[model samples]
Target: MDAMTPPDREAPAEAPIEALLRRRWSPRSFQDRPVPDAALASLLEAARWAPSCFNAQPWHLIVARRERETEAHAALAACLSGNNRRWAPQAPVLMLAVARTTFPQDGSPNRHAGYDTGAAMAQMAAQAVVLGLQIHQMGGFDPHRAREAFAIPDGFEPYAAIAIGYPGPADALPEDLRAREQAPRQRRAVADFAFFGGWRA
Candidate 1:
């Protein structure tokens, strides 16, 4: 039972910095409002500016509006476990992000592609926060089905899908979820995870 908060909160005095540090979070309850094309475009542009190794920007995004795809959306919804399926359907946009396995002119494995894609995803999510949007990254989808359904090219690997929209009422979420809706954020202290100079623990 991952916890969350109701959609209502006072915007911080400094919105941009607050959005960067405080506004970003993953919540399943999404309102059905239409996400503007310009905002979406800006989010993608932020991802485009993320750093990549050797300038090999290999992340690919395939976006789908939940209402637009009948069979596909149903299949996608079913692909997620019951809990995720509940609120994911309410999101207006779904993005399937992929990474290419080969570098141009080099047949060698592109080991860093996934890392670069992850960075781009982080940027996109952060940008969404700045734009008053919410995004949930899902690891429960059927990757094989996604590849076939989207006709993903041979070199590309389907990695993750994100559900994007505005936050919905906590009441719309399941009872178990509603209880933890306004939970506070948590993170490990820096000393716990970061090492100073050498391997002397």
Candidate 2:
């Protein structure tokens, strides 16, 4: 398992979790194969079902496969952070997740737009594992560049760039990324972050 893999579902746990959640990982290396349309639709469908504030479901995804949209893929790659640019370019599918900051029904401000978008991404990640694929989501990208490149409409915010593909050998990544790939997964205790009562004094 790589650093991104979740805890084993079969192992004893404080609470039960889905096996797909345990298997999902955000890996830097990926096999150079185009994602099939059916698999892609499944991933999007999972996202479609995510819960959202007032069921607004603000997430709007723009996906480009390496072989199908070469120029657009390159354009998206260019908008990524320098570190990500190195490894993400090889992914077969690259996507931009955008959020609509207002309700479509009456054009009211949506304070939970970001939160809703996150829920959608979480669904897609889990679905990817079910499809034997992995998705690495990154915040390191120029929003302005992406907006201009993709002609993003007003009131819509570009949230994250996602690289989707089948996991490849870690050795294919740069030496630094390879080391990070094999590192132990770390997380804070549930008690540390999840407060049950009033804020800790």
Candidate 3:
């Protein structure tokens, strides 16, 4: 581990779960290191295997490696919201996750497109952990600007902007974000959301 690397912020799971799942977390601070091409491909490969409704496979990623795709990376950075733009640009890689709103088999609306796309990104996040990397998916972005910048087709919708790289020390981030980076991870109890047989209010 590098001297600048932060300690693992593992989740305190109520039940046993995959070690990777426990280790996975989104960090705003990233080291100024390039992610290898092979590792990026592995992340996409993991996403490719995610199951989608009717096998539509609507998820698509527009990748921009800061050192490799300098112009594109800057353009993508411009699409982020002010808050995210602060730290996200520091990441070595940036990506825009988009989803096709219609099925390829038929030009009909696919309500699950966004849901399926999310699943794919989830897989990518796990794979990042495996590669000693982390991804922070941000909804705080200008979708309209992204669409214009990328010339995204009408049938596709920009879902999220992703920042990918090795985690860095919390102190690397701005004071506010540094606090969040060092904060303990929290989640709602399983009983709060899981209803065995019926909905509970």
Highest TM-score, which number? 3
Candidate 3 is scored at a TM of 0.96
RMSD of 1: 4.8
The per-prediction tally of clashing pairs is: 4, 0, 0
Model 3 lDDT tens row, 1-201:
122224548887889998788888989989889999999999999999999999999999999999889998999999999789899999999999999999999899999999999999999988888888999999999999999999999999999999999998888888998888888889988999999999996
Query: What overall lDDT goes with each candidate model?
Result: 0.75, 0.87, 0.91
**TM-score for each of the candidates:** 0.83, 0.92, 0.96
lDDT at position 41, candidate 2 = 97
Residue 104, candidate 1: C-alpha displacement in angstroms:
2.3
In terms of lDDT, model 1 sits at 0.75
User: What is residue 50's positional error in candidate 3, in angstroms?
Assistant: 0.5
Best-to-worst order by TM-score is 3, 2, 1
Provide the clash count, candidate 2: 0
Worst 10 residues of 1 by lDDT: 1-10
Candidate 2: regions farther than 4 A off? 1-15
lDDT of 1 by residue, 1-201 (tens): 111223333223332444354667777778778788898898899999999888788899987766666566665665565567767877888888899878866867789988999899999977887787878888878888888777888989888878888877877888887765555556666577778986646
Once fitted onto the true fold, the runs of candidate 3 whose alpha carbons sit more than 4 angstroms away are: 1-8
lDDT score for residue 174 of model 2: 83
